[model samples]
Target: MAGRIVVGVDGSEPSLKALTWAAGQAALTGDALQTVIGWEYPASWAALMPGVPPEFDPERLAKQILDEAIDQALTPAQAAAVTRTVVGGNAPQALLDAAEGATLLVVGDRGRSGFTAAVLGSVSLHVTQHAPCPVVVVRGRTGA
Candidate 1:
């Protein structure tokens, strides 16, 4: 059976870079490529405001982000061949779940809004340590 390659995208520059790199790898390997993105409500939303959820739908936002990332990162044919998934809850766990039965899992070193000083973002670190398959953490400084 042909293998699958799962890549995590979070709408960050590094994520876009990872997506592009993963797409090229998928094309070369003839493996199915799937992009997974995770989203969750801030803890404060549950703790401070119990009943009312934010009017902005995080799920929709996640989907939009995935779509935009795909557009920005991949060629038309590559984007058309890719599958997009938006998962709810923690990013690392969501990526790990998606990587099940896949040949490879790829992620960016850091995501959007993370601490700038961190060498590796928590999600990437966790997935690299615990992913079901081999993991690739794409890391580099983006040119201005």
Candidate 2:
């Protein structure tokens, strides 16, 4: 492959849309696709709250979400052409890090954060503002 296309995927509808778009671009440009899922411990956990431990494994959950998204957004051939990357850190920073040496960075307008419609999500905005390579934020189509 000539270059790598880095795509941030978090299992959201818009993210899947971005993934689909990125996959097509990767194929057209003869670039390898790297699907990245960045996660961090719950904010509340930082407080060392006296509560029961989390029942789910965040690492496993992240991998499942990424794999399911790949399955849903790409065909078997396309999926085989992709490489999954899992990182433990803030989403925006993780994406920026993954974009290093990449030909392009792609992400959704909003992730699972459930931000309001008034503005683009913070991660997308940050990547657009500071990513080393060109960044594409895929938002929902007006009438699609």
Candidate 3:
């Protein structure tokens, strides 16, 4: 059976690189490409804000980020072949769920987090340790 490759993407530079790498791997292996992005309210949302805006849509924003990342990272035809998934919740769990049946799970060494010096971001570290499939944490400069 043909395989499916799942990749976690945020609007980070490392994530963009990871997406591009995943796309190339998928193309080489003829695997279906699945790109997943997850979003949720900030932990301090209720504490920091007086009221939640009705117009605030985390899922929509997440989808927009994912879409833009795909567009920026891949060609038009390559982007069209991508299967986009917007998940509601934490990125690590979302990626783990999406990679449940995948042949491979790919992620950037670091995401949009502030920890640039660390070799792996929290999401990448978590997924690499827990993913069901073989995990590849794409290494690169973790700036931005």
RMSD of each: 2.5, 2.3, 2.0
Residue pairs in steric clash, candidate 2?
none
lDDT sort, best first? 3, 1, 2
Residue range with the least summed lDDT across 10 consecutive positions in model 2: 46-55
Per-candidate Cα lDDT values, in order, are 0.90, 0.90, 0.91
TM-score (C-alpha) between model 1 and the true structure: 0.91
Candidate 1 has an lDDT of 0.90
Q: By TM-score, how accurate is candidate 3? A: 0.93
Model 3: how far residue 36 lies from native, Å: 0.4
Stretches off by above 4 angstroms in model 2 are 46-55, 141-144
Query: How many residue pairs clash in each candidate at the backbone level?
Result: 0, 0, 0
What is the C-alpha lDDT profile of model 2 across 30-71, one tens digit per residue?
Answer: 999999998888778747655646675677889999999999
